[model samples]
Target: MILEQAILNIKPEESIVFEKAFAEAQKIISSMPGFVNLDLLKCIEETDKYLLLVKWESIEDHTIGFRQSEKYNEWKQLLHHFYDPFPVVEHYETVISI
Candidate 1:
């Protein structure tokens, strides 16, 4: 599996709206091919920060499958605006799991 991670820095005072938008947008992502699951977590120390973790069957499932699809436009409209400077997303493969 491939792990997608991002530290979302939301614009000041926009957390609530962002959360609602993300809740709506996640439905789009969940319907994509190769999507496994997702987790969105709020940072305890940073009120406007969120951590997004998504599992996919492969990196192409995200980079090409999702990003290249028309659904991405809807997803972007919903959640992209709330980002401060925009989040940097990265992918990883498991090194170890016990």
Candidate 2:
């Protein structure tokens, strides 16, 4: 499995609205091919910050499959505006797990 991670920093006090938008956006991503699961964690120290983790079967399943799909536009429209500087997304494969 590939792990997709991103640190989302919302614009100031827009977190409440962002969360609501994300709630709608999540449905877009969850329906994509090779999607396993996802989690959105709010930061304790920085209320405007959030951690987004998604599991995919392969990198292309996200980078290519999801990003290239039409649904991505809807997803972008829903959540991308909430970001300030925009988040950097990275993918990783497991090394070892207990």
* CA lDDT of each prediction against the hidden true structure: 0.97, 0.96
For each candidate, what TM-score against the reference? 0.98, 0.98
Clashing pairs in 2: none
Per-residue lDDT over 1-98 for candidate 1, one digit per residue giving the tens place of the 0 to 100 score: 99999999999999999999998999999999999999999999999999999999999999999999999999999999999888999999999999
The top-ranked prediction according to lDDT is 1
lDDT of 2 at 15: 98
lDDT of 2 by residue, 1-98 (tens): 99999999999999999999999999999999999999999999999999999999999999999999999999999999888889999999899999
Separate clash counts for every candidate: 0, 0
**93: Cα error in model 2, Å:** 0.7
Runs with alpha carbons beyond 4 Å of true place in candidate 2: none
Off by over 4 Å in 1: none
